[model samples]
Target: MNLAARVITELFQPTVTVALLLLFSPAVEPGFPGTAWFGAVAVLFVCVLPLAAVVLLVRLGKVTDHHVSDRRQRAPVLAMAAVSLLAGLCLLLAIDAPRSVIAMMLATVGGVAVLAVISLFWKISGHAGSIAFATAVAVLTLGAPWSPVLLLIPAVCWSRVVLRAHTVAQVVAGAVVGGGVTTLLWWLLLELTVRRA
Candidate 1:
């Protein structure tokens, strides 16, 4: 890979997307309501813990890279991630957290569920999928103020292609799955919450 692609891949990894979106939750309308610890619990369970476990796995040779670059190794990792994500979702839901946080968690569950299923047959671009989803959330939640972040999707896609981590088709598929699922989940959550009240 060339220097630019390497830089892009390193800079825009899936971990960055998770961290950025969670942190950015605060600037939008009604942010993540409740106590300040709400954000802490969210950041810890939803992002940090699973990420740390993955990093430890890499260090212990349970996986190859942060991306889980090997197709064969993806399923177990993704399955575990989905469980962690689901657990976090349950926690947030139990607390009666902000609607947006609950909605985002539901979207994440949707994305991971899709990834887990796809991993059985092919290696898809988790990096592209996640960043696209995060970008979509930013745009939907914060409107025009968050438009610039949408650019990250293509940049990350290019990096994945350039690094040979994914083909154009795979990355595109990932983007579609991530963006489509999250958008649907976000809209559905909002609409359903309105109905329940």
Candidate 2:
């Protein structure tokens, strides 16, 4: 892979999902003590623990790549990640965190569920899907001013192709699924919680 593609792939690795959620998470709010704690929990549960699970799967010979490059190995890892995300969602709800945070987090979990089902028959590019979802959520939460981030979707799709990790069709499917599903869920939840009278 060329350095540019490699760089883009690295920058948008699945880890970014966690980081972006934390960045946009309600934890940034100043007044709520619970919000700050929820942020920490988000990092630990959404990012740190799930990443540790990936590492453990690698070390245990259960997965062939850091990215779970082998399609066959993805189900167990994705299922575990989904469960972890659901747990994080529950924790946020139990603490009465804002609906936006909960919605974004659910979108993340929902993405994994969608990916898991698709992985059973196809090797969709997780990187492509994740970037698509992230871009959509960032724009949805931050408004049209943040729309430029959508450019990353094509960039990531190209990187996956360049690296030979996924084909053009797989990348395309991932972008559609990731962007479509996440955008729908997030918009619905945010609309219900924020926009509706």
Candidate 3:
């Protein structure tokens, strides 16, 4: 397959995107407690849910001998995107700063949208995206606590590459999608909320 196709596929992978969002939430908002619960929800919605859906689809495909194609695989990706949006909303609710929630949610969604658009047009390397995300986190962290959770994004990206599920570019695109979206959301949420007040 071409690099563009591969990058899009990797970007759409539900697991990587969702995991990145969850990992970065705490890093962005230190005052928002209950990282464990956020992590748990992310795991369930982002990882387990898509996995279960994949299993069911695989079983159905086998029973019907339906040759699974890229379109079929897109179901999980779509689910991941939906989950990421929901997770951002949940994170907004979890936060104590009412003024920031909406802006944060907007930034989160906007970032993901931008990443999706970019993935559609360009092929990104895995290391590049991972490094970008890590750097973004590091930059965002200048004022917040040094969160161990930040490491999870790279770990998830590595797993996808090691499993041969995605190339370096694809994984990196996923990282970009994950981090860019969340960061945008956090900033927007803060700004809008503050403005209204």
Candidate 4:
């Protein structure tokens, strides 16, 4: 049970979830494969490099674990990832990547910023939050058939609690932050883009 919980926790880490989300962003845009590399660029800066930072911090003993179970250790890491996200956002804009992809990046930056602020005072479940955000985005982008993806939120929350990484309330709050923030931001960005068009 413990091993399985750990696997689930690791599987839905923010880095992985964001990578999957970015990689799927092109699909949300009209011209897919053409803008596919934009997703790759996002994954490189927002996911891969930030992940590398966490790994390096773990090696240096700056972080308690790869997951950064210690809330105190999260701010710096989140800040580093924010920088990467910003850089990705700029590059995506400069390259005029698809509106959906750019909006996704912006939404991601918003989510990260929220999590970073919350983590400063509480040990929120980044794992749960990440999964919830992904689920929300999936449902929003794919509609009714994808609504089932919401199930992953509770599963991730259960895994976090089972792993003793976070309290039930913490996990719930994480879900709220993840799903609520991203859904609002992404939807708003897309809406604004459509209006501008």
Q: Per-residue error at 68 for model 4, in Å? A: 0.7
Candidate 4 deviant stretches above 4 angstroms: 194-196
Model 4, 52-131: lDDT tens digits are 88889899988988888988888999999999999988988898888878888888899888889989999987787778
| Candidate 2 weakest lDDT stretch, 10 residues | 27-36
The sequence of per-residue lDDT tens digits that candidate 1 reaches over residues 4-105 is: 988988887776776666555434335334343555566676678778888999999999988889989898888888888888778887987665556666
RMSD of each: 2.4, 2.3, 7.7, 1.2
TM-score of 2: 0.90
Query: What is the per-residue lDDT of model 2 for residues 1-197, given as tens digits with 9 covering 90 to 100?
Result: 58999899888987776566665667334455556556666667677787899998899988887788899989998888887888887888898877667767776777778989999999998898888878877776678999999999999999989988999999999989866886787778767764562
Deviation from native of the Cα of residue 109 in model 2, angstroms:
1.6
Number of clashes found in candidate 4: 0
Per-prediction TM-score to the true structure, in the order listed: 0.87, 0.90, 0.46, 0.95
Against the correct fold, how does model 3 do in TM-score? 0.46
TM-score-superior candidate, 1 or 3: 1
Which structure among the candidates has the greatest TM-score? 4
Q: Please give the distance, in angstroms, between residue 37's alpha carbon in candidate 1 and its true position after superposition.
A: 3.6
lDDT, candidate 3, equals 0.50
Error of 1 at 96 (Å): 2.5
Clashes of each: 0, 0, 14, 0
> Model 1 — which ten-residue stretch has the worst lDDT?
26-35
